[model samples]
Target: MKAVVITSPGGPDVLQLQQVNDPQIKDDEVLIKVAATAVNRADTNQRQGKYPPPKGASEHLGLECSGTIEAVGSRVSRWKIGDQVCALLSGGGYAEKVAVPAAQVFPVPDGISLTDAAAFPEVACTVWSTIFMTSRLSPGESLLVHGGSSGIGTFAIQIAKHLGIRVLITAGSEEKLAACRDLGADVCINYKSEDFVARVKEETDGKGVDVILDCLGASYFQRNLDSLNFDGRLFIIGLMGGAKAEMNLPTLFAKRLTVQAAGLRYRTPENKAAIVKEVEKNVWPAIAAGKVKPIVSKVFPFSVAAEAHKLIESSQHIGKILLVPS
Candidate 1:
């Protein structure tokens, strides 16, 4: 098997494709012949040695992939050999083959290509688990998404809008904001020139949004709190702006706000399976109905994984970037 190897803790240049042993599946897992894998910010962090794979997970870079089932374990019943599926992986999506728990695998939505199905698992599970499952973001409410043009942000906007939630997003550029608007974002704020907290409040009629999905952790923490309505929920998934922050306890007390953070990679397989099930039940329908779609910015062959990483780090791409095995 061939996979992208991180030679050292550094930039995208550290990624190198090389031959490796094919993964062995456990009794409850299945082997996927990778068709495509999506690049994520966490992959970059892992390459830089900032985020290590969870214990017993594949040390490779990819977190999600779409592929054909080459083999299924004895304990796996729902999936069979030759099933075309996409899976939520803990790691090791950057290879020709990966072993994953069968429970985390999903049937590709009707009308979606097998390759593009690679874009859904990570972003879908991340958004669904955090805001909808935990924060309980319901219809007729307003939600704000930070990094509006990102993979997670793009998916979040469409799904939220489909569910009747008013969507507001913050992006750094007008082009990015325009993309968000076309994807159903009702309010778009350019963080480079305007204040998102003020804009969020303004769009919600000064009451603030009912929920906020933030990736810029520390730099936007306090401001996120200020931009939330009373009893609002703020879910943080990444710390791109740094991890440490000083929070005003009074704000939480005054507004009865809830601040929470989580990552999909380190979760127990059982937990991830539950989230995957919910995504299949809720999100897949929207996708099949053409209400939600995969927003792929670019596709790179596995040999050029570093270039894909560079594109993601540059924040120039509007949606998910994919890597396919050559």
Candidate 2:
């Protein structure tokens, strides 16, 4: 099996493709012949020595993948060999074959192709967990998403709209904002040229939003807090804007706000399995109904994963970027 390995902490140029031993499965895991996996911000961080895989996870870079089951473990009765599936992995989706716990693997949706299914697991779990499960965002409440054109943002917008929630998003360009609007975002603000806090206030008649799905992390921390209404929940998932900031306790107390941060890759297997189960039950039906769909901006062959990394770093794409292992 050929896998993309980081030679050292640096840029995309440091990634190297080399043949490695095939993975062996454990009793509750399955070995998949990977058809495709997608590049994510976490992968770029790992390549730059900023993020490392959780203890006991594969060193190769990839968080989610879609493929066929080449082999199944003894306890895996729900899925069998030859099943078409996609999985949320801790690592190793960059290779031709990877092993994952059976409970974390998902059957591809009824109408989606395998290549596109590769884009589903990570964003689906991330958005569903952060906005719905953790924050408890309900219908009739307003929600704001940072990085509106991103994989998570696009998916979040569609799901919220379908469930009768008003959505507001921030992006860098009009083109991306237009795309977001087409996906059902009720309001789009150009973060480069507008004050999002003020805009959000005007749009909501100064009541603020109930939940915020943020990826910018610390730099936008204060503004995010300001943009919240009473008893708002701030869910931070990415730190693209750096990670150091001072907190204002007075405002936090006044608004009765809740700030929570987490990463899916480092979760316990039981937790990941639970989230996967929720996505399969609550989200997959919407996908099968065409109310939501995978937003793939680009796909590169596994041999050219470095190119995929470069695109992810550039941050110029509208949605998910994928690498297919032929």
- Highest TM-score, which number? 1
* CA lDDT, candidate 2, residue 256: 97
Best by lDDT: 1
- Residues 1-326 of candidate 1: C-alpha lDDT, one tens digit per residue: 99999999999999999999999999999999999999999999999998999999999989999999999999999999999999999999999999999999999999999999999999999999999999999999989999999999999999999999999999999899999999999999999999888877777889999999999999999999999999999999999998999999999999999999999998999999999999999999999999999999999999999999999999999999999997
Candidate 1 residue spans exceeding 4 A from truth = none
How do all models score by TM-score? 0.99, 0.99
Clashes of each: 0, 0
Model 2 segments more than 4 A misplaced? none
lDDT of 2 by residue, 1-326 (tens): 99988889998988888889999999999999999999999999999898999998998999999999999889889988899999999999999999999999999998999999999999999988888989999999999999989989899999999899999999999999999999999999999999999999999999899999999898999999999999999999988888998878888999999998988999999999999999999999999999998999999987788899888788789989999974
